[model samples]
Target chain A: MANDKSSMQLVANGILKENPIFRLALSMCPAVGISTTVMNGFMLGVAVLFVQVCSSLTISMVKKVIHPRIRIPTYTLTIATWVTVIDMVLAAYMPEAYAKMGIFVKLIVAFAIITMRLEMFACKEPVGASFWDGLGMGLGFMIGMMTIGLVRELLGSGAILGYDVLGFKPLLFFILPSAGFFVVGLMMAFFNYIELYYKRKKGFKS
Target chain B: MKNIITIIIRLTLSCLLAAFVMGIFFVMTSKAKKHNEHVNEEKVMYSLLGYKVGAPVPETVKLYAVYRYIVTDPAGKSIGYLVPTGQGAETGFSFIILDLDGKLIEQKPVTVTADDAAEAESRDKAIKAALGAGKEAVYADDKTIIVTDNGARTAYLLSGKFAGFKASISVMLALKTDFGIRGLAIVEHEEDPGLGAEIEKGYFKNQFIGKSFATLKTLDVVKEPLPDAYAKAMEGVKGEDGGKILEQYKDHAIYALTGATISSRAVTNGVKGTVAKFAYRINILDNVLKEQHIVVPF
Candidate 1:
């Protein structure tokens, strides 16, 4: 609404400037926890995607009717309810993937990125716009997770998605919790460097 | 006053709308959910029963919410029951299967007959004593299930929760009727990945597989700094049968998974306690089943 940005820019913002992982640094708990394997990250990412989109759409529709003074609670109620629904629905239907994301499903309620979108974007935007924002954020999260997962799994376990890509284990440290933070920080810095480099180039033209 | 009234109305409306949407989803999924849940259970049962890959689909029995059943390849030839335990220590479940004659093979499914319905009521208390008392349920149905061969229970499929170094670890344990561990699957866990979580991998879990149980009552978690010869000797005996491994391993002590000693001990202790309690429960149930001659005299 402020700049009348295109839908694609909104999507790009989640991946680059407003990335829940890199820029905003939200949902770091899961960002580190599940990135141990691509399979783990993929399953959790899908769960987050489903919850993120649904909650955004619902919150957008109800924003007007909801009291501003109580909007935060309302948003929480909406997100938690959606999370339970996703957990049950997955358990009830998709038994295979649900197996991969056992306890992580319940942990989604604690994700700050999911709630932040509901508060910042979904609250003010129309349902359609909010839906796009949710998709963008979810995709960004998925990319971040996969990037971390790919690096950790490949380096730590010498595998990717359980496939033995390397003949043997490379750097075992990458898979540990301590290395989890290291890899994420390095990736965040790498992405930031790219952003800065591009910005300086753009400034030179101006 | 007017503002407060508007606030109340807004909150109430949102709550109602949320309720309405949730109800629709709940009703939509209720039936399919039940059907899908039994799918994983079906696979786990078959595997534990030693039906090799590509075995024919086993016939299944569903008795209300508390019990699960699977009729093996030959129809009506054998039955397996998933006993849901909401009482006793561990407060999970045990898979009991019986031959047509009601003998405990591996795991059996016994019916609650009208004549023994009253006695069956006491079965919970009796069975609870097997798992000990006051244990909370940790593993859910989806977390684990047990299966035995149609002819005889080849193994006791055990699923229990282990308090790992980080989070609770849910594991499926397959123990042969002879107290040998057939398999161990770390289904869900939150341990440190490269170290503690390696318990999920083959090298660690495979060590316990096919190793006989000296006593289910307790297992020693072999601390690190293991002698080289002992470690290599242990690997050579992986999946080897008999009490030799039990003796060599010292009171059925499970060697800690390399640098993940705490996580290793958690699984070792949890599985040991659960199996011992379950074995005792089966013993109690055996006595109770044997007394059918009295027809409720005791």
Candidate 2:
């Protein structure tokens, strides 16, 4: 199935056609929980991106050796190992960024997005194809998180990336966790609307 | 059976490989991680002493860490405290043992090797061995820091922790020689962002500054809104003007965060308890030092 599409197409598929956040709706917890500020969203996005790519690549490489019965455990172990290594590296080299992203970095292990990719795409795809798929999905999640964070931070705190843009909070309700569901739902609908618009423009059936 | 055996071997081999890879990274990063932690702690200490980050600490400013241990009998009854005396290399690595009543029991030299000091278990073992059988010196619950500028005592810093909205919040508070608060830094917490997390904001933390031990004893968290003037001053103004605004509210209760009164109260009560305990402990330490006629090297 991967051979039917070029590597670039695979990446685009992950970003648009099967976007992890808005379309597949994988890992919605972090998308809502940590998307209070753009900086948080960006930091967590980078962490997830790194972990996803590394774990996907590792799983694809070792797919043959992993027993079918134990593949799930192996994938979990691989993801956890990468997360720990990345966590330590960030703590040592990027202390300031680490201070902000430390807790979220550890939380990446529990993100269904990374594990789902390994099981569904990486286990069957070639190494290079798996890498591109991971990148695409990671980028998709990052963009989704940043978009949510931008809206929430702007409306909730009247700030963008911590700089005051509106000078006063116009809608403090946007910062609450309940606002997260509304934002995600609206974003999903917006993406679907765009997709439907393009499909109809192409003269495709609904 | 044959297929099962092969699968088990593969799983075992993969697990071993994962462990091996993790072990290499752990070794490569452990030293750098330790160094980073040490530097971060030094930064916290300097900040607590009112030294701004990025500016070099002046040569005249010195910090002395006094490690206090509660020496307990085998039955867990607290018998005394083992406090190290002197500073830097001047330390003969000797500990002055004082009973609960602040009477000096003995001054004994305990050798803590360089390697043993790196690990807590080994270090505890060495200290325990020196104390002989049936006596254990458990480390104190809080940190005691003495800040000196030139030859004069400038401040005393203490670290304490208390339950906040989600988890325990660790804070390091600086106090003037007379026990008035100088500043406070929230070292770590798990409070929610945009709400309980606002406790770390300057406007909230600065409220604790300039509050005397007397004021702290009765300090409470009030639901009353923070005065707009004081809030603006706390967030923007620094130096003398900010001090005046904080002083004006010195007698007032802490202004609770709009949706985080629990966190606000937690920090206020935590600071109050920390100061009260530090005052009592320091008083005992001072009397014991005077009675022993041993000039503290810091």
User: Judged by TM-score, which candidate is best?
Assistant: 2
Over the full model, what C-alpha lDDT does candidate 1 score relative to the true structure?
A: 0.69
Candidate 2 Cα outliers beyond 4 Å, as residue runs: B79-82, B86-90, B99-105, B112-126, B236-243
- The TM-score measured for candidate 1 stands at 0.72
Off by over 4 Å in 1: A1-3, A203-206, B57-162, B170-177, B183-189, B215-255, B284-298
Q: For model 1, what is the error of residue A206's alpha carbon versus the real structure, in angstroms, after optimal superposition?
A: 12
In candidate 1 the C-alpha lDDT for residue B1 amounts to 95
Candidate 1, residues B46-127, lDDT tens digits: the string is 5545565577645441111223233343334444444543322323444454555656555322333322322334444433
lDDT of 2 by residue, B1-298 (tens): 9888987888788888888888888888888888888888778878777778899888988666556777767544443443445655665445567776666777666677544543557756767777888777887665577888875889998899989987899998899998989889998888877788889998899888888888888898889889987987778665557667767888788899988899999999889988998898888878877777766654
CA RMSD of each candidate after superposition: 9.8, 2.5
Index of the highest-DockQ prediction? 2
Best by lDDT: 2
Backbone clash count, each prediction separately? 8, 0
